[model samples]
Target: MNFDNNKLIKIIKFNLCFIITFIPSIMYLHLVEGGQTATELWDSFINLDFYSYYKMIFFLTASFFLLITFLKYVDLNGIKKTNYYLPAAVYSILAVLSSFRAEYKEIVIKGFPDRYENIFVLLGYLLLVVVAVNIVDNKKSFKLILKALFISAFILAIHGILQFYNYDLLATEFGRKLITPDGLDFFVDRLSFVGKKVIYSTMYNPNYVGSYTSMVGILALGLYSSSQKKNKLFISGILSTLLFSFLIGSRSRAGFMGFIAGTVIILYMQRQFLKKHWIRIFVIFTVFTLVFITMNARNLDEIFSDVLFPRTEQEKYLEGEILPPITEVSSEAGKLKLKTTEAEFEIIMASDQIEFLNKQPINVYNSKDEVKEIIFKGKQYLHHSFQINEKENYLIWNYGAKSAQFYYQDGQILMAGMHNNLYPLKKVESIGFKGYERLGSSRAYIWSRTLPLLKDTIFIGHGPDTYAMYFPQDDVIGKLKFFSNPEIIVDKPHNLYLQVAVNTGIISLLALLYLWGNYIFSSFVLYKNSDLSSWKNRLGIALMGAVTAYLVAGFFNDSVISVAPVFWIILGLGISLTILAKGN
Candidate 1:
C-alpha cells in the first residue's frame, strides 16, 4: 500500500468526489424557518427540506479541498496543462465580484431562499473540478468514480420507480418523519401537501430528475459500449435502460432534449462501432421504445393535450372558464379603470393615499394589521386574510403560496412590479419566438424577459443565485398570461446560457462556454485519434457524451445543486482523461 502523503491526499480527494457524487441521492430532510417580519405565522414554517444537508456536505468538502490544495497536499505531478481551468477560475472570480454589486447582499452571498447556489457553492463546484483534474491519475480511480455514480443512479432510479407506482416513500410514516423536524409531526398533516407529482426522486423536481437521468443515462450507454465481460455488459445495459425509463417517467422535455443531443453525438463518434455492433444497439433501442410506449400508453390523451399540442397559460386563462370575466381595463391621466362581470373599479393617484372606488365590495388586506370585516360600496364582506406590503412608491399585494403579486405603478394597477428599483424587470423585447411566448412551457416568455437583462450584465451581473431577486417578480400580467398564475416565480432563466449571462455576467458566461467548448472539442480530438480498445479512451468519450447531454438539457434547464455536482465531476474526469490521451 502506498503510504506517501501525495497518495493519501489523492485517496482523500477521490473519496470526497465519490461521496459528493453519491450522497445527494440520500433523503435527508429538515425544516427552515422563514425570516423575521414574515407576514403570516404559517409562512415561518417551511417543510419538505431537501437541499440543506447536501449543501453542508458540499461546503465542508469544498473548504477542506481548498485547504489541502493550498497546503500543497496533492500530487503536483498529476497536474497537466489545460485551457479549461483558467476560464473556470475567471467565471468563479466574476461570480464573486458580482456579489458585491448585488442589492440583496445576504441572499447573494448565502444564496436565495430554497435554491442555494451561493458564491460558496460555486466555489465548491470549482474546487471539485480542481480536485478531479489533479487527483484522477489512473484508470482504477476513474472506474471507482464511475461506480459511485452508477450506484447513486440506481438508488434514485428505484425511488422514482416506486413513486411512479404510487408507492412514494415520502408518503410513508418513516418517510414523512425522515424529512420532518422533531415537534413537527403534528404539523405533518399540514405538510402533507396535496397535488404532488410522482417521480421527482431525491432531486425535489421532476425537471431536475430529468436533468439527472439525462446525463447518467448517457454515461450508462458509454459503459455498455465499453464493457467486455457479459456480466458488465448486462449490468451497464440494464442501468442504461432504467435511466432512460426514469427519464421518461420524469416527463421532462428538457431531459429528452439532452438525451437526444448526447445520443446523436455518441452515434457520430462511434458510428463504426455501431455498425459492427448493430444488433446490440438495435436491441437497446427496441427496449427503450417499448419502455416509452408502455409507460405513456395510458396517458396518450395527455400526449396530445399537453405534450404534442399544448395551450399556453395565457390561452388557458383567457379561453378557460375559471376566473370572473374581465370586460375592460384602462389606464390614463393617473387614473385606472378595471371592469369585470361583478364590479367596476377606479383607482386615482394622489399626494397622500390612492383613492379606491368600486361599485361592489372591495376587500383590502393590510400586512401590518388584520381587518376583521369591512363594507365598501354597500356590499358586505367577511374576514379576509391576505397580505399587502407597502413600498416607498409602490403597493405590493402578494397573493397565495405562489406569491403572485399585483402592484400600482403610475396610478395604474399592474399585474407585476415595473417600478421597483431593487428587482427591476426589463422592457419587453422579443428575440425570435415573437408571438410564440407560450413555447416550451412559457420558456419563451422567460427568455423574452431574460435576454434584455444581458444588456446590463455584459461585464458585471446581478450576482450568484440572485436570479430570482432580480427577476421582475411583479410581472403578474405576463405570469397570468403565460403561466395562468400571476404569482409564478420565474427564478431560473430556464435556459442555461441565459441563466449564466443573467446571474454571473456575460464575460463569466463566455468563460464557462469556452471551458465547455474546449473540453468537448478536446474530447473529440482524443476520441478521433485514440484507440477505442483502451478503457481510458472509452471512459473519456463516455464522459464527453454525458457532458454533451447536460449542456443540451441546459438549453432548457438551469444548473441545480442536485445535478450540477455530478456534471462537474464528470466534466473534470473527461478533462483528466483527455490529458491521459495526450500523454498516451
Candidate 2:
C-alpha cells in the first residue's frame, strides 16, 4: 500500500511539473491594466508581458520544486555531478552580466534603459534544465515528457488547420481571445491574397510555429521508431502527421528549410530502422506532401510569380509608364486629381499637415512634379507621407536641380530625383518562376548595410537587445538607398548568430556555440556506441536531428521568448538522456 501510494505521488509530481512547463504556451492571461498603470513601464521596455508572466510561473514552480527536492534529498549532488551544470551556470551568469552592460550602456548612450528581463528569463531556463534533469531521471518520466509535448503539439496543429480554413472555433464559440496587454499583438494577416492563409496557430508568428511543429514532429518520429508497443507507435504516427501538416501550412521558408534539414538528419541517423518501416515512412511522406500541395497550390503560385519572377522597378519604368503629378489639390474634398494617373489620390490635411492617400498610393513616383522645392513666401515647405505597410513616415525636401532628399522619420536620409530609377511605379507581371530574384526581398540590401557596423562591436557587443537602437545610427545604413527609412526598426540581425554577437557579445556567443557543439558531439557519440536495435539509442538520434533542424532554422530567424523555452527544454532533455546513458 505504501509503495503504491509513493508511486501515485511520484506520478502526480511529474504530471504537475510537466503541465507547468507547457502552461505558458497555451495560457494567454495578463494583468488587466486598470486605473493604476505605469505609462513609463509600457514605453521604456520591449513589451513582453506574456513572456514575463510565463518566466515568473516557471521560476516560482522551479523554486518550489527545488525546495522540496533539497528537503527530500538533502543535497544538490545530482545536478552538481552532471556534465552540463557548470557550463549552463557559466552561460547564465554571462547572460545576466551582458544584460546589465546593455541596460547601463543604453541608458548612457541612447538615454533610454533596456529592459533586463532577459536576465531573469535566461535564469529561468537554467533552472528549468536543473528541474528537468532531476524530475526526468528515468525512461518513464522521459516518455511522459514526450507524451505531454506530443499532446500539446497535436492540439496546436488542429488549431492551425482550423485557423487556415477561417474556422477558428475556439475564438468564435469559446471567445478565446489572446490578451495583448502591451499592445504587441501577434494576430497578423500574412496572406498576400484575401482567401489565402498562413497559419500561426497559438504562436506569435508562422516561423515560430513552424520551427516548433518541426521539432515536435521529428521527436515524434524518434518516439515512433523506439516504441515496442503497437499502441505507442500508432499514437506517435498520428502526432507526426498532425505536426507535419501544421508545419507545411505555416508557409515559412525558413521553417521549410529547417524541416528538410532535420528530416535528412533523421533519415541518415535512422537508416537501419528505415529498412523495416520503409513502407510506413513512404506512405506518410506521400500523403502529407499531397495534402500540403493541394491546400497551398495558390500560395505556391504566388511565390513563383510575385516573389521569384515579378518585374523589377527598372523593367516597369522602361515600359513607358509615367505617374501624373497632383495638378489640383482640394482641401474640402480630401482628394487630389493627378494629371494622368490610373487611380485617384486622396489628400488628407490634419494638424497643420498635408499628406497623400493612406493606402498604397496609385504612383510611388510622379515625374510630372518638376518643382523640387515647394517654397511658400521663401520658407522651405516639406511634404511628408508614409507608404503602405511602412513603419516610418518620410519627408520630401528639395535638394537642388529636380533632386529631393527623402528623410526617414528616424533621421536617415536618402537623396534621389523626383523620378528616381529606383522608385518607379510598376505593376507586378507574373512571368512564371525564373529562379529567385537577385535581391531576395531586400534582405541583401539590409545585410549589406548591417555587416559594416559589426566591426566595432566584436568584443562586448552593443549590449543585450540594443541592436535596434544602435543599428539605425550607422552612417552607411542611414545613407542606404533602399532602407533609409528610420521608421523601419531593425530590431534583430535576422541571422541568429549575428543577433547573438550583437546582444550577448562574442564571449557569450562562443560559449553558447560551444555548448551546442558539445551537445551534438555527445549525442552523436551516444548514438554511435549504443545498439542500433535499442529504442533509447534511436530516441537520442532523433533529438540530435531536431536540434540540427532548429540550428539551421536559426540562420534565418531570431530567437523569441515564445519559442526559446521549448528549444531549451529540448536541449535539457537531450542532456538528461546523455547523462543517463553514461550512468548505464
Candidate 3:
C-alpha cells in the first residue's frame, strides 16, 4: 500500500484519455453517412481517420506501452494478468490464422503494409484495452469510471441538444460538415430535415446523436439510482433531450432499439430507489416520446414496425421474398412495364387520407394533426439542417408533409404490395420495401451471391479485409445490373457471423460462442453472486441487454467486421468486464 487512498481515485481518473476516447466513441453512432445509408460502418482499413488515424495510431501504441509499464510497476498476481492475456492470445491466434487464409497472406506476415494494415488496428485496440484494465483494479476505479461517464456524457448531452436545435455553438461558425472516406461533398445536401437545418456534432451521424444521448441517459440513470442530486437537474434534462433527439434522427432502428433498451435497463437498475418516483419517470418518458413524435411522427410506424418489434420479425423481413433471376433481354421492356403499371395503378393511395387530401403534393413528415399546422411546426421544429426548396419539389419542408410523408405513403404502398407482381410475368417478390422500384435493395442480392464463396471457405475461412478479393466479380452487380452510387462499396461479407466464419473458419464460431458464453455466464453470476456490488449487477444487466439488442439488430445489419464504432463499443465493454472480474 504505497499509494494513498485518495491518490488512487485521482490517478485512476485519467482525464485526457477519457476525452479523446469520448469524441471518437460518439462517432460510433454516426450510422448514417449523409443519410445515404442506414449505417456508417466502414471496413477496417477505411475506418481509420484520414488525417487523424496517424495521431490515433500513435496514441494507441502509446496506450499499450503504458500498460506494459504499469504491469511492471504494480506487482500483479499471475491470475489477473492471465485473464487479460487470454483474449489477446485468442485474438492474436485468430489474426494469424486469418492472415494465412487471406487472399494476401504473404503481405500480412513478411512485408505486412500492403494488405493487412487494418488488422493492426484491431491489435492496437486489444493492446489498449489490456493496458486500460491494469489501471482498473478495484471499486474506486469503477467510481472513477462513473465520474468519467458523468462529465463526458454531460458534454455529449449538451452537444446533442444543440444538434436538435440546428445550432452548432461549439467550434465552427457553420454547422457540421461530413465528408466521405473519399472526400465527396455529399453531406451538404441534407441541410433541412423535417424543415429544420440538421446539425451534427463530433458524433458523425445525426443518428449517432441517439447513441451518445442514450449512453448518457443510461449513466444518468445510474447516478439517479444512487440518489445523488448534485447534478440531478442537469442529468435528467440531458436524458430528456436525448429521448427527443432520437425522433429527430428518424429511420435509425439501432438508435431506437439502443435507447429503449438502455432506458429499460436503467429503470430496472434504479428500481430499488426509483420505485416511488415511477410517475415522474413515466412523465419524463412520455414527454420525451411526445417531443420525438412531434418532431418526427411519420417515422412512428417505422419505429414501431422495425425498431421496436421483436427480432424474429426483422429476420423475416431480411429473408423476404427471394425470386429467381430474370434473364430478360430488354431493359426497356421492364422499365416500360413498370412505368405503365405505376401509371395505371389508379394511384391507389395507400390510405383514404392520401386521396382525401385533394392531392396537394401529399407531403407529410410525421404528424396526425392538421398536417398543414404540422407542416408549420415541422418547419419551426424539425428540418433544422436545410430549408424547403419550394422551387424544387424534392425538398423536405414539414414534419408530416415533407419527405417523411412521401416516405410513409411510398413505404406503405410498397409494403402492401410486398408480394405484388414485379413484372407482367414474375420476378423477385420478396423485395425490400422502401427499396426503390428500379433496383430491389442491392444489399440482399449481394449477400445472396456471396453465400457460395462463404461455403467454399467454411474451414479456416477467408481473411479479414479480403472480401474484395474474394467477392464474386462476374456477378450481376459487377457486370449486368449496374445502377449508380458506387459508394455502397460492399467489398466484404455483409453478414457478421458469415464474415467471421469466412475469415477465421471455426475459430469465428468459437469466438462467437465464447463471447456469448461469457455474456450469459456473467449474467448468471450477477444474478446469483451476492457479493457483487449493486453497480456491477446493474452495469452487467445493461451490457447484457444492450449486447443482446445489438446482436438482434446486427442480424439484419452489416456491422460486425467493419471498423465500426459499435464493434469497438462491444470491445470496450469486454475490456471493462475483464477489469471488473479482476480481484473479485
Candidate 4:
C-alpha cells in the first residue's frame, strides 16, 4: 500500500509537467472549431463561451492541484541562472488583485469579484508561464510543444475542410444545433442574444481567422525550415492546404493585412535562417507553391478586397461614398432644407443628453438673456455656447451601433464600438488625412485621453485591469458609449501597451520593455549564435515576425484580451524566444 501511494504521487507529478507544457498547444487549437480545445475536451463542463469565467475556474482548479502535487518534488538543481523572480512575482500579485478588481459592477453583485474569477484566470497564465519556463528545462520539451503544434494545425485543417462542407455535428442543451461560429447554421438573430460570443464566423470573427492564419503561417515557416526533412515536408503539405483556408477565413481588413505582413516577416526570417540544407528549402518552396497554386482551401483572406469574385452592387454601395465624413451632427434637424452655415432648428436634447445638460447647464449659457431667463425662471440650456463654453458638448455624429445596455464598460471615445471605422472624425476628417475613408484605428483618441488617467494612478492602476472604472471620469465629452457608471463591461484597452501599462504599472511596464528589449538582443544572438544548426532561430524569427504583425494589426484590431487568441500565441512566442537561455 505504501509503495503504491508513492508511485501514484510520482506519476501525478510527471503528468503535471506534461499538462502545463502542453496546455498552450491545446489552447492554440481552440482558435479553430469552437475557439477552445478545453471546451471541446470538457464540453459538458460549462454553459457560456469558452473564454468565460466557468472555463477560467476549471483551469485554476486543475492547475492549482497540479501545482501542489509538483511542489512536493521541487527540482532545485534545475532552476536556470538567467531566469528572474521579479516578473513571476509581479504576475502572482496581479492575479491576486485581479480577483478583487471589479471590471464591471454587477460582476461584483453577481460574485465575480468575490470569487476572483478574472484574477484566477490571470494567475493561471502567470503560473503557466513561470512554471513552464522552470520545468521545461531542455530541447525535448520544445519539441513536445512543436509536436502538439502539429496536432493543433492538423485539427485546424480538418475543421477547415469540414467547415467548407458546412458541417454541424452537435446539438446544444437549448435545442439549437451545435455549429461552428461561421457554420451554415448562422441566423441574423444569433448576435442579438450571444453578446460577443463567436456567433457569425467559423473562427469567431474574420479577424481571428486572419491571426490564426498568420500564426500558422509562421509556425509552418519554422517547421518547413527545421533540420528534419520528412517533418518539414509533412508540415509543408498541411500548412500549404491551410494557407488557402486562412485566406478565405480572412474577413476583416486587419486580418488580411496581418497575414500579408506576417508572410513578409516569415519570408525574411526564413531567408536568413542560415542553414546549409538548401535542398530542403527548395523542396519546401516548391511544395508550398505547387500546392498553393493547385489547391484552393489554403487561401485565407481578411479583407473583402482579396475575395476572388467580382464585387456585388451592395458591397460597392457599403464600400462606396455615402456622405462626406461627418465631423459634427448638430441636430440633423438643422439641415431640413440644407444650409451652408448654421440654421435655426428646434433644440431638444435626448434623455441621456438631458441628464448631462442638467449637470452643467450653466456651463453652456453666456448672455444675460439666456442666463437671467434660466436663473430667474429656473431653466437650463440654450441654442449655442457662444458666451458659455466651447468645451461643452457640441455633437458627435454617431451612426454606428449603440453601446451595449447591461454589459461591459465602454472605454475611450475613439475605441468604443464594434465597428471602429465610423469614428467621430470631428478633427481626423478635417485635414483629409486619408486611410480611414473605410475602417481605420481610433487608438489615437483612446490613448491621448486614457494616458493621463494612468499617470495619476501610476502606482497600482485603480486595481489590476481597472481602466473602465476611471475612464468615464476623464471622459466629459459624452462621446461614443460613455457609460454612466463602472458596471458596464468595456473589456478592451484598445491599445495593448496602454492596457499593460495601466493594469500592471511601471515595473510591469519595464518587465515588458525588457522582454521586447531582449527580443532585439535575442534576434541578434539567434542570427549570430545561429550557424547551420540553429533550428531554434526558425521559430524565434517567425515569432518575431508574428509579433510585428500583431502590433500592426492591433493598431486596427483588438488583440489585448484573452478573447483575442493571438495575444496568447504571442505570449507563448515570448517564452519560445529565449527558451534556450544561453543561446549558441
Candidate achieving the largest lDDT = 1
Query: What is candidate 3's TM-score against the reference?
Result: 0.59
How many residue pairs in model 3 have overlapping backbones? Answer: 33
The global C-alpha lDDT for each of the candidates, from Candidate 1 onward, is 0.68, 0.54, 0.42, 0.42
Clashes of each: 7, 1, 33, 29
Better of 1 and 4 by lDDT: 1
The local lDDT score (0 to 100) that residue 135 gets in candidate 3 is: 54
Q: For candidate 4, give the lDDT.
A: 0.42
- In candidate 3, what are the lDDT values of residues 396-487, reduced to their tens digit? 11212212112122223211111111111223223232222222224455555556665566556565555555554323222222222212
The CA-based lDDT of model 1 is what? Answer: 0.68
Model 2 clashing residue pairs (backbone): 392-487
Question: Which residue segments of model 2 deviate by more than 4 Å?
Answer: 1-24, 27-80, 104-117, 176-196, 225-227, 297-459, 473-486
TM-score quality measure for candidate 1 = 0.79
Clashing pairs in 1: 314-481, 404-487, 415-476, 416-474, 416-475, 416-476, 417-474
Positional deviation of residue 14's Cα in model 4 after best superposition, in angstroms: 7.7
Q: State every prediction's TM-score relative to the real structure.
A: 0.79, 0.68, 0.59, 0.60
- Residue 237 lDDT (model 3): 54
Q: How close is candidate 2 to the true structure, as a TM-score?
A: 0.68
